[model samples]
Target chain A: MTPETVTLILDIAITISLVVGAVFTLVGSFGLLKLDDAMKRLHAPTKASTLGVGALLLASILGAFARDEPSLQEALIMAFLFVTAPISAQFICKVNLHRRSCMTPPEPSSDSTWATLDTADAGDAPAQHLTPEKG
Target chain B: MSFVDYAIYGAFGAVSLAQLLAMVRLILGPHTADRILALDTMTVNAIGLIVMLGISQGTQIYFEAALIVAMLGFVSTVAYCRFVLRGDIIE
Candidate 1:
């Protein structure tokens, strides 16, 4: 293939990736807006948005290669996002659980309560010292 | 403009629309968790926008901005969750 053909192919790939990324991002946000329940809404951003950004980053990487710069720093962003997306989702889930904002999760057969819901005895962990004293 | 140019423009419009939708959610969200989720989604969309900008301009400078936004967004989400869960971010 000629050099022009290769450049054309790369450009097509980058464009396709960009379009896909944008569509996913829009769908994710739309879900976030229209989902009936909070927990359901949580699924939209965490899953779809991550995939969207990942696609965009892939396009960025491809674009760099096409431009002859061949930089991989976009990979750093992708890796960070992939690692953190689920973690932040979990944290938000915990927040939802703590606030009782959504349907309560089913009880475990063995455990009396979920760890997040289980209140510790005062003796188990002292909390008195953490409170600020009023003058 | 070529097909690539049209695609780039379309992607920009779509991502910006996504950001606007997330913003509406942030304002109208019934629960704190919903708001937090909206903010998180918006952050992700912002990163998309930055990446798109970088792609269109063929520049590398936006990479750092995107990375920093990602880090800050994660940290802020965790902090918000902590505050909601225990009423304190540190403890």
Candidate 2:
């Protein structure tokens, strides 16, 4: 392809992706505030915001490519965010459960139960020793 | 402004609006976890803004800053949750 066509393609890609990313970010943030339950709040930023940032990073990659600068950093950012967002979401969910901050947690399957504050009713035990004792 | 320039402005404005909403959630949170979520969202939004700004300015340095912020945000979120879960981040 001619250089001009390539640049045009990149420009279009950047525009669409950035716009999509920003809108997703806005919606996710809105959900964070508008959702009544803490767990519902968790749903917004973890999933939608991660995707939003990924799209923005993609746009940045295209922008950098168009400008003939290094684009790898944008890819790295996307990888890092994708890898960590879920782990952080898990941490946040655990925090909510441990603190009993949410209204109600989902019921664990019959095979095994979760160890939330309500379920782990043992008194006087320190938080550090929360794991179930081995046989 | 050109259409491309206008697009950049719109993206930045939207990301900024998202950041504002995240901040409001952070302040109005009745639960600590909710606040943490809001903060995490803010961090991601900041990354978006930084990238967009970099695009608008035609620079590359902001990518490093974005990467650093993403790493730090993850670490801090995990630490906060660990504290809430077990009262300490490190055993």
Task: Name the candidate that leads on TM-score.
Answer: 1
Candidate 2 per-residue C-alpha lDDT over B4-37 given as tens digits, one digit per residue, 9 for 90 to 100: 6778899888989999999998888777888889
Over 4 Å off in model 1, which ranges? A121-135
Q: Provide the global lDDT of candidate 1 against the true structure.
A: 0.88
Name model 2 segments beyond 4 Å from true: A117-135
lDDT of 1 at B2: 68
Per-residue lDDT of model 1, residues A19-120, tens digit only: 889889999999999888888999888999999999999999999999999999999999999999999999888767766778879999997988766667
Interface RMSDs of the predictions, in order, are 5.1, 4.6
lDDT of 1 by residue, B1-91 (tens): 6677788899999999999999999998788888899999999999999998998898989999999999999999998887766667784
- Assess each prediction's global lDDT (C-alpha) against the native: 0.88, 0.83
Clashing pairs in 2: none
Q: Deviation in angstroms for B1 in model 1?
A: 2.7
